[model samples]
Target chain A: MKIFGINLAGPVREEVERFLASNGLKLEKDVEYTAVAVCREEIVGTCSFAGNVVKCFAVRPDWQGAGIAAQLLTHISDILFSKGITETFIFTKPENGQLFSGLGYRSVAATPQVILLEGGTANIGRYINEMVREAGINGTEKAAIVMNCNPFTLGHRYLIETAARENEQVIVFVVEENRSCFSFTQRLNLVRQGTADLTNVIVIPGGRYIISANTFPTYFLKDRQISVYQELDALIFARYLAPAFNIRIRYVGTEPHCQVTNNYVEALQKILPSYGVKVCLVERVKSKGECISASRVRQLYEKCHWEELRDLLPPCTYDFLRNYPNPGSQANQAD
Target chain B: MDIKHPAKAGSLESNDIYVMVEPSSEEGIVLELDSIVMRQFGRHIEAAIKETVTKLGIDNIRIVAKDRGALDFTIKARVETAVKRALEE
Candidate 1:
């Protein structure tokens, strides 16, 4: 048997899809690199990776014990190392946990349907330890909020304010993935500036462990699988993040329009409480009977309606938008 | 020797080891070793790694070694190669 890398396009892509289907797996659309193990000129094992996360891994039933999966993983690791990605993650079925653990991957979090694991140079412990050291979080009655804040809005400030008022310390995790209109750095800065008045609030990047491409690839998953991923994401927060920071409550704004956000809130509600962390869903702050949302701010900014946006956004966000070069054109392409 | 970039050598096959070396903010060497035979040969394997890194005149680096029952010579060679590759960049 020989293992080699293959571009996931043309005839090779079709063969991989057929191979994965026979093994009860589907090809995730986000996979960037694929490698296959061929025995007797037929595909026996396959693995694919997108960024640092591995997906669509499988081996023929007869070839399972022959070390085919290990060979494919070695090939993928070489590719990842070449690209300077030392931390690797995999989301797989619960039963395959042992198989990966033997290959030096440690389990991060797991739900009934899916499990998350990490390997290579970085792990969740280091990520959490570094954050804890930097943030100096020692209090026990702290609350947490995770936000994308495509651009910080007045509604975000309100939720953070409510959490700050109720808890001894409030940790605001700005989603670090750059899939939104505003980059992660921009969103993080806006959240930091917008909540500067809340002395108890601490804003930091959510890192790869939370709502990131590795943890929750919402853009590539189906509707049913989305909720499972949401549960897995929430489990990580409840299990690792909350305990490390001594966070007891999580604050979220009530979703009025987006079904995905609502599902995330539902997942947090279902999982966090059992871990002793309460989920507090604050009502969305409204302006003139309409709820203030980041999307609304984005719409007005795209139309260059500063008069309307002045009410929806905080002073920092409004000033940033006013000085931003070609704001309307950039806002039009936002997710 | 200074590790200018993160680099790795070797593979995860049986009787093989994967070694990764990168620059660290903290002083001295930070080594994390995971061997299948860690219970019996963990200290010996760690000694082989530190001896190799020290011989190379490297002072501050972080190394992650995942061993699948590799021998001492194999570990030393992989560590030296990974450190060299890290410094070359």
Candidate 2:
């Protein structure tokens, strides 16, 4: 058998789709690289990696236990290492957990239908421990909030303020993924600046564990799969993140616009409670009888509506926007 | 010797082992090993890895080994290859 890389488009793509479909799997659109093992020009096994997360693994039943899967995985790992990505994650079915476990993949979280596994240089335990150490977390009744905060807005500030007032300590995790309009560093800095006044609030990077491309690949996914990914993401938060920081309550702004955010909030509500964490839905703050949102702020900024944008954002965010050169051109540019 | 970058060698197959080596922030060698025969030969495999790394004079590194019943010689070779690759400029 020969294992080689295959482009995601063309005849090879069709063969992979057919092979995966025959094995009760569908190709996710986010796959960046794929490798297939072929025997006599027939696809025997395949694996793929997208942004450090590995998925869409299928080995023909007749070829199972022939070490084709291991070979495919090694190919993917080589590609990832060449790209300088040390951390890797995989989403697979529950039954195949042992197979991957033997290959050095450790279980991060698992549900009935799907299981999240991670390998390579970094793992969740070490990540959380490092974060806890750096943040200087104390044994207080802590609450949690995870937000992308594309640009820190008044709405986000309000949600954080409410959590800070209610809980003894509020751990705000700024999403570390750089897929937003603002870069991760800019977003993280804006959050730290915005919440600098709250004595009990500690802002930290969400790292690769929270709402990342690996944990929640919300873009270009079917509606059903979005819910599954959301649940998996939520389970990671509940089972690992919350307990590590002693966070008993999670605060989220009620989503009235984005269906994806609504589903995520619903998933959090459904999963966190069973894990001894309560979900608090804070009514979104409004400006002039309209709900204030980051997307709205982006729109106003794009339109150069400084007067309107001024009221929607906090002073820190507004100042940052005013000083930012050509903010609109930076939209959708990943850092 | 120092591991300047994260590097890996070998494959996850029967009678083989996968070795990953990276520079560690702290001193000393940090090893994480998983083997099918861990209950039987875990100590022997660990000794092989340590001996190979020590011979290479790598003092501060992190090694992750997933063994599928590889012999001591195979383990040493994979570890040596991975450490050397990591040391490459």
Candidate 3:
């Protein structure tokens, strides 16, 4: 059997669809990398990926138990590996979980109908273990804070400071996904500058393994499906990430404006402790009883509300905002 | 290579190359290249495409290649595939 890449938007996609339909599976709309296993000019098996997660995997009943599925998976995995995606997740039926388990995937979470399996040379478990080992800290009380810090406002600083004060050390994982108005480098730099004085805090990139775009695409979408994204994100963090960091507490700011954030906090509150990761919601930093937020700062910048924006940001962030070029008028100097 | 029709191949994903080919009344191959590594590998990529199309023995065509750091083999393969698809009757 020969495995070849097929574009979902191309003519060959119909063959893939027919193959999937024959196996009682439907096409997953978001799939990107799709490979069809062809034998004697007939499509015998198919697999697809959405980010690092494998979806819509199917093999013809006649082709099953003959190693076609394994071949297909290996082919797709090679492609993903070449692109620097080492870790991968898959959602499959519970009965088929045993099959994947034999292929190096370990079951992380499961329900009667569906099971989530993660595997790779650098899976989350190994990655965190390595990071912790390199850190050389044992039995030190640690708290975790995952922040986007789109522009690193005072609100974020307040949350991190609170976490730092409560624990011996705070591990600050800045989300590495570049979906914000500021680039990842810019955001990371802003957070670094904003938190430079927090001697007890360790800043690190969250990589693509944490609340990444791969795991939580909807979170970065302009119109978010907040509840669904929140539940899934909270589950991944509580089940995998928090433990990896050896964090007993995850500190977040209470959301006064964004109902979506409040809902996420609620989900974290319900789920984190169940997995031994405590959720702490610190009251947000406020100016005149108004919660300080990155989005608010962006809005104020766009409106040229420098005075209010300055109030909402820390000195470092305020400086960055002041110097950030205005997209509306390219020629005008940032005031 | 000579283009008998308009066709396309490849994807815009990282480490992939997208090629769009169409019939051109112009006498020789007109190649347009856009790549993230245009400053570094741009000349090499163009040379690969030119070699592949010349080996295919078609002269009059239009080629638009959007590259995302594809390897030399990938560039050649994608260009050949696109040329063949465009030459299809």
Segments of candidate 1 deviating more than 4 angstroms: A136-140, A212-215, A218-220, A302-306, A323-335
lDDT of 1 by residue, A1-335 (tens): 88998876668899999999998887788789899999888999999898889888999998888877778888888898888889999888789998887776788998898888888887797788788888887756789999889899999999999999998889999988777887888889989988888888999989888973224663337535788888988999998898888889999999788787888889999999999999999999999899999888888787888899999999999988887866575665572
Error of 3 at A63 (Å): 4.8
Better model by DockQ: candidate 2 vs candidate 3? 2
Best by TM-score: 2
Candidate 2 docks with a DockQ of 0.72
Q: For all candidates, what are the clash counts? A: 0, 0, 2
Better of 1 and 2 by DockQ: 2
Decoy 1 TM-score against native: 0.90
Task: After superposing candidate 2 on the true structure, give the runs of residues whose Cα lies further than 4 Å from its correct spot.
Answer: A9-11, A212-215, A218-220, A257-259, A323-335
lDDT (tens digit, per residue) of candidate 2 on A216-332: 663326435777777888999998898889999999999788787888888998999999999999999999999998889988888678899988998999999888876563652
> DockQ values for all predictions?
0.65, 0.72, 0.02
Model 3 DockQ vs. reference: 0.02
The worst-scoring run of ten residues by lDDT in candidate 2 chain A lies at A212-221
Ranking by TM-score: 2, 1, 3
